[model samples]
Target: MIDARGPEFAQVLERCTVLLGTLFQTRNDILVFPGVGTGGLEAAVVNTLSPGDPILVATSGVFGDRFARLAEAFGVDVRRLSIPRGRAVEPEQLQEALEENSDVLAVLLTHSEPSTGVTNPLAELAPLVRERGHLLIVDAVSALGAVPAQTDELGLDVVIGGSQRAWHMEPGLVMLSVSERAWDASKRARLPRFYWDWRHAKNTPDRFLAPYMPALGLFYPLENGLHEIDEEGLPRVWERHRRLGAFVRAGVIARGLQLFADPAYASNTLTTFKVPDDLDAGALRERLAETHGVLLGEGQAELAGRLLRIAHLGYTSEDEMRSTLDAIQLAIAAERADDPT
Candidate 1:
């Protein structure tokens, strides 16, 4: 392992942060943490809000619910505006919720709902929150590089991302792009924090060093991944994901499977579909993995055994996606032949 405190490492980190800003389309300060995406969510909560501070959480799927639950755990008064599974959170709905809860200090929104493969309209929703003088914290863990999130243009306060998502890196690092307003809010906010404190993690002494040792091993890979993203170009990357999403959705539909996410707001990174009522979702997934060497994500919580998610994100090629779709078709056909209604 390289010296984490050395200047060489610092340079690598600084470059990664700059690339991260490019990915988020923000010139704001980007903070890196040595944990998973959920840790970034926790950091966003504790850094900007005090205990009992009311906030509106717009939830469209499992990840959204998790963020609301996380805020509740921090003693933040969470007013959850839940949308139906597979449906994006409408701007009108958020406007109404904000009007109803005028005392809310901030708005927690999931940019891309991974569980249901729905991508919320951040451009439409950001103005509603910002116009009301509320902080906008976005969970863009799965959406960052794959989707277009103009953080600076949207005036989002805090946007969280993960290294493992669109970057195709390992799961040891999380990033948060914090706006100037968010930094000011952190000064007055009072909620217990030690490890996740942005103050402690901020670059110090012009050396780009953190108070504590970060995920050293992840830094190199993170830098390399960011460079790869830079080489590909962000706009082109987004277009690729968009095309992949459309291709997967069309393939699924041709196979007679209904999509779980609204067609208008479907995610570019992943596609969720309903499992036929007669077939066991778990067994079908098993058959796909064991026989076809393809693994699929299972539905979470109440939707378990009813939906399956296919991811087309992170360095995946169209050929790979086509093969995955073919595998799904074969697996479903085999399962049906074995248990005919």
Candidate 2:
């Protein structure tokens, strides 16, 4: 049914409406979706930058790390400000990194690092980028909807979002924003692209917002989700994420687990904690799910097995967080009883 060309066009417009609402929420102009999250990142790197263009990439966790890798993949010269996991990048460090790269075209960073449960200071980062006359590209995929971003005031040139996160929609749909500077840079960049050309997508209204036909069925659910956020009020939805995150973190600390992130910078969508060195983190996750039917996220890279992530995002509530914490404590106690060392 969706394969029909006529219906696909209308659905594509619906997709655009949903995307425009999400991107505009960040307060940026000219939203684009080269493909999805990764595609949006690629387009940012390829379209707005020439090979060997200087750029500063702020890396705190997995997504920020991906930004550096993607920049290098497009042959852009990358200068990294390596903030340690669980910490936000200070403005002073960004100043130092920028001073070292005088020709920087853009500064890339994640608004929220889902892997490390760290939310960086994008409000601070954006102005610094603007002061240096460099565009700020934000990976707000996990931050948008779940977090509050005043895109216009922040001076961010490009912002990215994915449908799977707080948007509460199916994957495959992605959102992006482009500013005037980013659009101007497109003229000189020589990256090989086909379906990802933003100029083409922007010009050809008939082909929909993207160069290719998208997942049309996703628009139906995505529209519903966006409308739900609109009705609830975006700020109120963000407040829900904030309050639940704090409640969960408080409960985790109450249960005697060490929080992995600084409370000031802790992501309002999720929290991570270091399992007591004596406890097996992997076993803790399993018993919680098998015994209590509660699923939680695990850490990545160096944090794997050392930490466990607790998500308080996406249609979750305070009661749910309390129950999740209760289950976690039970799981740990059960694991200790079965094998005490």
Against the true structure, whose lDDT is highest? 1
Worst lDDT 10-window in candidate 1: 202-211
Regions more than 4 Å wrong, model 2: 2-8, 11-19, 26-35, 203-210
User: Residue 234 of model 1: what lDDT?
Assistant: 90
TM-score of decoy 1 = 0.98
Could you tell me how far off, in angstroms, the CA of residue 269 lies in candidate 1 after the best superposition?
0.4
Writing each residue's lDDT as its tens digit, candidate 1 over 1-341 gives 57888888888888888888899899888999888999999999999999999999999989999999999999999999999999999989999999999999999999999899999999999999999999999999988888888999999999999988756589888899999999999999999999999987776447687447877888778888888888999989989999999999999998889999999999989999999898999999999999999999999998899899998887888899889989998999999999899
lDDT of each: 0.91, 0.78
Clashing pairs in 2: 26-151
Give the poorly placed runs of model 1, Cα more than 4 Å off: none
- Candidate 1, 289: how far from true, in Å? 0.4
